[model samples]
Target: MEEKQIIIRGRSYPLFRCHTLIVGSGAAALNCAYHLVSFGVRDILVVTERLGGGVSNNSGSDKQTYYKLSLFGEGQDSVYDMARTLFNGGAMHGDIALIEATLSAQEFYHLAQIGVPFPHNAFGGYVGYKTDHDPKQRATSAGPWTSNQMYQKLLIQVRQQGTEILDGFEVISLLTVGEGEQKRAVGAIAIDKNKASSGLDSLVVFQAENVVLGTGGPGGLYQTSVYPKDHLGSTGVALEAGAAALNLTEWQYGLASIKFRWNVSGTYQQVIPRYISTAADGSDEREFLNESFPSFGKMGTAIFLKGYQWPFDPRKIENYGSSYIDLLVYQETVVKGRRVFLDFRRNPAWKGGAELRFEELESEAYDYLHKSAVLFGTPYERLQKMNPMAIQLYAQHGIDLAQEPLEIAVCAQHCNGGLLGNIWWESNVKHLFPIGEVNGTHGVYRPGGTALNSGQVGGYRAAQYIAECYRESTVTAESFLELAGPALERSVGLAEGALGRVASPNGRIWLEFREELQARMSRMAAHIRDAAQIERALAEAQAQWEAIHRFEFRLEDPARLIEYFRDRQLCLTQLAVLHSIHAYLQRQGGSRGSYLVVDPQGSASLEQLGPEWRFRPENAELRQWVLQYQFDSRTHHTAWEAVRPVPEDHFWFENVWRSYVNKEVFRDSADSR
Candidate 1:
């Protein structure tokens, strides 16, 4: 390794050289760094905007789960069953599901060994519970902070392994070299947030042989999002570097507290709160769910079911499940021009002025409430009895859920799609790997806690692959400088152009543009989707992006520079999402997962709801295809690829024979012969 430095604005910035550079400070990045050191790869650097500030460390709810196959269940349970369940979720690749399922248990136990406090029963068996889209009880928890616990433990391990972490350094761009199959990721350009904010020109260039992106999802891009407001992810950078994105239209949206931005799910929903809608001025109060459901018991049971059925799905709309509650809430709030709230102060009342009866509720809902000892009180009292921490957690964030009704709405929770990758987590750009939320491992729907598991699994796989395959490869300073020259020029030119525009009196600020972009996305691309609206949004977004380039910036304010770059990245990502949605609608791809395409004929009539409430299903044949969005830098145009399924033969005997024929089984004997 050689020392390289660059002079900028009369200040010298060091260009740190390393074997591997991991972007992000969350569980996935930490785990990857730890595993890399364990594999004897030194000179590792972990760069992040903030330490312990990612969704994994900052977000939680009532008993957050880490989903994996049962470690001590009945002998009938197997990884193949888990894989099938995952694959059947639609829009997911079979091979990816099988790989994640096979590695789930190993990653789960590894986290536990690293000091994650997974609960075990007296019989020395790990207890498990069911989660969304899961057929088996394969989900377990370490209280609500399951991911945070994983992050803390992994952070400790990474520190102990002597890996250097550059906190507050946000990676702005990925540097790549060569062309086509010979192209490879060599390094990245980063800016220091603290120094930039303090009016200092501080930038660090990292030259590495391998780069792992664990920077999570595009949270800041959404106006109504559960992700922390400051979570600036790397998906945009990857896309700009010509990496293909998978299933950009698929995402998870659910009801969360408006004030705290925390998911009001599980026990918070199971207790059956009174859903009230009011005007923005706090007038015109009405019990909204009662208007939507035919009976109090139906609405109450749906609320109870929301504990597991969190994300809104059109398929679950008329299925007598809690997900319909989300549709109703969205209709009431976004469509009908009303504000919604979850009032736990009292039990829900029937339209006929009858008191709620326990027997009238569904059997499962009644049993869950009974087992939790929440059978006979107001929703607030029941919530306190069931999970007191839920109320207290909100209080810590300056919202008293117990005293006041929590304002709620359908907000973006998780992105199921991201940078496309193989089983090793490597993206199209060689030497560049994406892990955690940035890796598009999950498809249309996923079980709760699978994101955390996927992050760990991806980190482990990427680490092993890098160590086994690229440890001996040389990444010289001269080669890195040569490869990074064009990217560097582009970044510098963009910055200089922005600085030049700052002299104009009518130039817009980055914040105003960001807010406008978020508002437009929330209106068109978030939960509800229509062809006209999405196409309009794409056009507007393109205009906004073009307008953003004309914005002026103060050279002294480094924060503005960071925001400028982030906003640009977000605009590109938003365009990708909207274009994907537009193409899907054009191809007659119907609503699956979190995607809800509006029906033209207005088929739905939930209490005579408007056209926005009407949803139509896609053709059944479309389920066999996955839509891929790729940016072609050569033509400066976006291209779409339909990934159709290939024939798969999964017979057990055939698999064994194939393994033998490939010399995977009894490899030593076959090699000797």
Candidate 2:
């Protein structure tokens, strides 16, 4: 790596030049850097706002899973079988699924080899179990902090390789060259959070041959979210820099504790805690679920199913399914304006009498509890017996689940869709690879813990592609300086406008905008959707975006300028996502993934929920295509494209050897669009 200074707005700012620049410090970014060094491409620099603030390090659930090919089991498995399983999840492209499947073992073993500690038996077999949407037992875990373990181990490997990482730098722009289809990603521009008060010292620029974006999801887009608060994500920069996003309408929303921002999945739900709600002043406490569900057995079964059927899937809403519980919670909290809680301190009150009837419970719920020897106690006792780590985890966060009720909301947890990436994880912009949650590879319904596997596989593939095809910087120092000039000027302009402002009542403008956008998203575009409201919300988002450029916020502290830019980017992301939702609705898209499309003319999800709960069933044919959007210069262009089919490779030994040796294997650019 080389460093210099470039004059922007009559001030000298630091300029860096490297072969590859990584824009995050999560498990995927670390894994990419580690593999780049192993692949003999060592000129790398990783820039992150903070080292340990990402979701991979800070967020988890009960027994967070890591899905891969079934490594050791009596059931037979193959690469195609896994690929088909992933592809059948709807809206997923087959080629990308195939690559992920084919590399599952390699990446899984890589983590295990680097000390992730995915458990194995005495016979040295990495065992597996079933996860949501699984046809076979292909899920495994070390503990609740599975991704955290992966991040730690990968960080060790990257540090051992002497890779340079810049902490406290938040990337705000992707520096590009050329125009139209000829445009290429040359590098990026980031702000120094620690030095933002200073004029020239506040900005840093990188000129690299290739850029790996592992910035996770747009976690800050919604008010109700389980994503770590500090991990706001840099995807808006990529989207602004000519990257296309796919399936932006698909997201995973589930019940999660709000105060500490932890997923209330797995054993947390299997323990069958009591569901209650209270008024704003903690008055009017009532059992919300008991009133909605017809019988105790049905309610207990639904609660138990929430352990595995964690994500609120529209398909799981009928017949008093597990996701029906999510709707009830949503109604209690969002619709009725009350606070909901999971009370593990005592058993749910039985309308049938004081004594609970274990015999009357659903077989799945009864058998699982009976087999585990936890059928004879209260929810807290059952939790302590089944998974003590669940209680200990909350206790660590100062929320004693054993002593008090846990507040929860149906919150946005993951985006199954994001910036579009091809089989090798390269985005529409040449030399820019979006790995991890930023990459839209999962489609609609991914198996639990598959995100971790996808991130690992994406990093490996991006690194391999970079090592083979994008090893050298074609643009020279002077040329890079020339290409980065426009982006730098814009950054300087924004900074100039934001810095050294007088303290005013409007100083909280950014905060107000944040609250407005987050609330709008949580209410209008989350688990429930109304097409008319979404259209209006899109217009409001656009107006706010325009307001941003009009200097709506005055910053008393220049340090707050970082947040200014972050929210500025977030505004654009939110706009793009809303636009995507509107476009999908315009295309007659309905409730399919995690969200529901409420159509008054359609049937009610449940007759008792009233006409407002009416939602249209999914248009099954839409699953054959993917929704893609590109935002450029305030223009939103969205279209539907047929899903890419899985490729059939003939493994003729001699021909494969020839392609591998001559580097023809890396020459396929079919899906780079």
* Candidate number achieving the greatest TM-score relative to the actual structure: 2
Query: Residue 334: error of model 1 in Å?
Result: 1.9
RMSD of each: 3.9, 1.4
Residue-by-residue lDDT tens digits, candidate 2, 206-229: 889999999999999999999997
Over the stretch 234-303, how does candidate 1's per-residue lDDT look in tens digits?
Answer: 6888988887787888899999887777898899888888888999888988887777677777878898
TM-score of each: 0.93, 0.98
TM-score for model 1?
0.93
Candidate 1 displacement at residue 653 in angstroms? 13
Which pairs of residues collide in candidate 2?
none
Model 2 residue runs over 4 Å out of place are: 500-508, 670-673
Number of clashing pairs per prediction, in order: 0, 0
Q: Which stretches of candidate 1 lie over 4 Å from their true place?
A: 1-3, 7-12, 197-200, 352-355, 550-558, 602-607, 634-673
Cα TM-score of candidate 2: 0.98
